[model samples]
Target: MIIVTTRQMQQMDKNTIESFGIPGRVLMENAGRGAIEMLSEHFDLEGARVAVVAGRGNNGGDGFVIGRYLMEMGVSVSFFLLSTRDRVQGDAGANMDLILDLLAEHALSQFIEIPDKDALEAVTEILLDHDLFVDAIFGTGLNADVRGIYRDVIELINDSDKAVFSVDIPSGINADTGAVCGVAIRADATATFAFAKAGHILYPGNFHTGDLEVVDIGIPGHIAKAQSPHIFLPEPHDIAGLIPARAFNAHKGSFGHLLVLAGSPGKTGAAALCANAAMRSGAGLVTLGVPEKLMPVMEPMVVEPMTTALAQTSSGGLDAAALDDIITLLADKAALALGPGMGTDSGTQELIKSILAIASVPMVIDADGLNCIAKNPDILATVKAPVILTPHPGEMARLTGKTTADIQQNRMETARNFAEKQKVILVLKGAQTLVAYPDGAVFICPTGNPGMACGGMGDVLTGMIAAFLAQDLSPESAALAGVYLHGLCGDLLAEDHAFGFSASDMVAGIPQALTTLLS
Candidate 1:
């Protein structure tokens, strides 16, 4: 789905009304009707009682229209106006006029305009008693924080102990940053128009917009395509098309070869997991390279994985002598999964720097591998290889010389900056994993949970990306596809003993997730 910012949506609306010749008022009526239809699809509104909290904007016009429809359909819907009917302007003013005449002719409940301070206080309990609260007090245009009476009223509705259904967007949340503006109404569901707002899919905003329903508000698809928004919420079908199917006559050699430079001594589990995950991720073959001293131990850990012994320091880390052999091996490899169990000893760092200085295949760098590059962040510039750096917040902080808090505060910016400067894709792994392209586009994953915080998670991701690269997917496609599948596996396992499960459990679910795509 196309995820747009407030500016993009407004521009689209303006162009639709002006360029496409769709009347603005016509679009408003369609948006309101579309939202009602969406709500009706999931809910039985035959007798449902609703409260529409309206402001003096187009969003308020949407609320008023929904109220009129609900009332016409034998449902009880009361409109609580933040201001008097005379203050409503433009399309909103026009819509309120129609509603006022309808209420007067039918002797229906007139919209309770907060005439004064006493009236405002009295409406608090009245709003709290409804089955649903419709938030149309604000839309994406709100740039400043809401305060005074508006803030207090928003808080009152939120504390109502009733379910909420926001129109266009929930009031007081910044559409671009997803930051709460003074106060915000936590909607149980939101019906936004045409394009899905970036805030709906982003962290705190997504959290506030429960079960978002993107209503078709008459915006043309070509105009949206023309806008060329950089952000997107990747769906399964989108990535499913990108997953290349094997040719009918395909053999093991046609699948792809993956190289894994991992393992010390005690951390052989990381190497084993990386190699095994590559095989599961559809790699034709996987070669597990370990410190020469740990080869005997690593060999026993693998059954089908090919093994290589790299020269090691006394600490069982890869020595500089290992580079020539690694280059020779990389000649036949399609991609490389680096860092997993690779130690951070000087000799290992030297070996890593050597491989990165020249390795041409796609690379997924993680763990100790990332720390090696942290010593010289600029080394990322010289490496011509297609690189994907999967870093947890601490590792990201190390690479950027910023605090973890700083990175998290503006994750999109931090990841995009690092990736652009380094000329590599960055997968900033956390609660909502952000995969940032060097070109400044960032994708926020809505999947994955706290359970994925365990060890070997990053290792699994490295292997997955390597396997995708081996199959000829571009660096951006590989990272996006890899993280989506990784989180999906976690989401599936979450259904049964998933949260209690470990990183290996997420790895185990990888094949299951592929079946959904492969089929």
Candidate 2:
């Protein structure tokens, strides 16, 4: 599904009204009707007590239209206008006028004109008694912090213990960035127009926008296509297309070999997980190159992938001297998975630097490998091989010299800037994993849940990406497919269990997730 910014959506709306000749009022009516359709499906509108908290904007017009439809359905709706009737203009004014006439002719139970904070406070108790609320006080265009009477009313509605259905988006959310503008309504569900906004999927704002339903309000397909939304939420079929077809007669050698350089004195689990995950991801021959002393530790832990000992430092971590051994191993390897469980010793960092300087195969650097390069990111520009760096927010901060908060606040831009500058595929791992390419294309993975926030997950991901690369998928395709399949596994597992599923559990789910793609 296309995830659009506020500007892109607004422009699409403009083009729909101006170029496509769809009247603005017709769109408003369609939006309100579609929202009502979704609302009716989930809620019983007949004889139910509901309040429509309306502003003077187009979003408010939607609320006004909804109020009329609810009244027609025998739903007792209280229209709480944030501004006087005369203050509402454009399409909203037209709808408000119709609602006012209908309310008087039918002698409706309520119409509270809350023009100021004092007016809103007077009706707080009355609003609390309503069974449901329709929040149309603000929409996606709101960029500044919500204040005055609107803020107090929002607080009152939240405290009411009643379910709220938001129009377009929750009030006080920045549609483009997904940042909450001071405070926002925690809606039980949101009925959006045409396409899903970025705020509906991005965090903090996503918390406020519950159960999003994108309503088709007659925005032309051509207009939306012309806008060319860059962000997307990939579906199963989309990911399935990225997976390369395996020939029936293909042999192990035909699949490709993956080399995993990981493990330390006491961190054999990370190395074992990385190499084993590669085997699961269809890499023909997976090998682990660990510190010579740690060979026995990983050799017994992982049975499928062959293990080779590398020159080690005194602490039993692979050192720069291991580069010669790694080169020898890489001769048969189609791809490399580096950095997991590799301790951050100076010698280990040197080994990472040496590998990057001359490594010919596609490589995925994760965990401590990312840390080593964060110390001297200039080495990224010097690497000749195709590179993929998977980092959580903290590692990303260290790499780009920005605070973790800054990276989180602007994930797409931060990842994009680094990928473009370093000429590497960047996978920003977190709640919503983003795969960014040097060409400015960014794919957001909507799969995965809080259950995925565990250790060894990144290591598994490192191996998965390397496996895809080994199978001859492009770096961008491999990174995107890896992140999607990884998250899909967690999402599937989440259906049966709330937590306690380990990275190993995720590894086990890989084949099932791949099957889901074909299904």
Candidate 3:
């Protein structure tokens, strides 16, 4: 599904109003009604005491509409206005007046105007008595930290422990970055109009926004299409459609051969995991190339893939001198899976440079391979083949020469900028892994869980990407499908239990994950 930023959503709303000739008031009405429909789906309203905590904005106007609907339904709704009634303007003022006119003599008990912090405290106890809350203090336009009466109101609503259904977005959450501004409302659910915002899917904000329901508020399809949203969350069919169909009469060579250069003395397990995962990911054949001395160790560890001993340094990692032999070996390989478990020895690092210069097919570079290239990222420009770099935050920091905190704070931008500059596909691996393309488009993977945080997970992912590439999927398709499948495997394991699944266990779940997609 398309995920828009705050500005993009605003533009979409504006286009709908101006270009499509849809009145802003009609849009507001649609929002209010849509929210009611969403609320009705999740909650029962008969005789319920609902509180509409509203500010003097469009969001507040939406609250007034919801309150009016509830009142008509015989559900008692109290409107606690954060601003003076006169301060509300535009479409919101129209909605507020309608509520006032409809309430008539009942306004004395149903409408309480808490115009400032002093009045806000006076009615805290009364507001807490409601069975449910509708948060409308702020919306997507809010860019700064929330303060004063609004903060107090949000905190009180959260402290009440009542189920909250927010209008547009949760109050005090940054609708663009998903960052919490000061204290924010922890809603049981949110009813956002038009499209899902970045804040709803991104962290902390995602945590604050419990169950999200995106309500269509009469925004024309052309308006949203005109905005050209570049960010998206991949669905099951997305991966399933990209997966190449297997022929009934095909042999092993019909898939493709994958040459994986990995492992060192102590990290042979990493190499074994990568190659084994590649085989599991449907690669026709996998050749594990390791340091000469570690051949005996990895050979028995991985059964399906054939193994080869490459020239090694004294430290037992592949040496730069192995370049000639590697070039010869690559002659028949469909793709190169480089980087997992190859140690950070000087010889191995130099060997990485040589391999990058000579690789002709797509390469999935990870782990020690990424670390070596962070030392000389300029090598990325020299690589002739399409390169996919899988980097966690620390590796990304090293490559960008920025702090890890900066990378995490701006994951989408950092990944997008780097991929565009280097002309490579970047898989920024994390909770919500980002697959950034050279053209500035980004795909976010929502699968996987915290249980997949253990070692060897990236190695498994590296192999999966290579396997997809071997099947002739483009770099983007391969990365998206591989990352999604990798996460799905972990999510499946997480369903049975949490936190103890190993990388090998994840590999075992690959076929099941693929089945889910195909189905």
Strongest candidate by lDDT: 3
- Return the TM-score for candidate 2, rounded to 2 decimals: 0.93
Which residue window of length 10 is worst by lDDT in model 3? 102-111
Between prediction 1 and prediction 3, which has the larger lDDT? 3
TM-scores, each model vs. reference: 0.91, 0.93, 0.96
lDDT tens digits by residue: candidate 3, 1-519: 988888888888788888889889999999999999999888887667899999999999999998888877777889999999999999999999998888875543388899887897788889999888999889988888888888888878888789899999999888877888988999988999988987888888899998999888988887787775378988898789999889899889998999999998779889989999999999999999999999778888999999988899888888998899999989999999998989878899899998898889899999999999999889888899999999999999999999999999878889999999999999999989999999988888899899999999999999999999988899899999999999999999999979999999988989998898798
Regions more than 4 Å wrong, model 1: 84-87, 115-118, 143-146
RMSD of 3: 1.6
Q: Look at candidate 2 and give me any clashing residue pairs.
A: none
Summarize candidate 1's per-residue lDDT along 381-455 as a digit string, tens digits. 779888999999999999889999998776776887787777889999997798989887788876787767688
The best candidate by TM-score is 3
Candidate 2 lDDT, tens digit per residue, 77-114?
89999989889999999999898788765555578899
Best-first order by TM-score:
3, 2, 1
Off by over 4 Å in 2: none
Clashes of each: 0, 0, 0
Candidate 3 vs. true structure, TM-score: 0.96
Model 3 pairs whose backbones collide: none
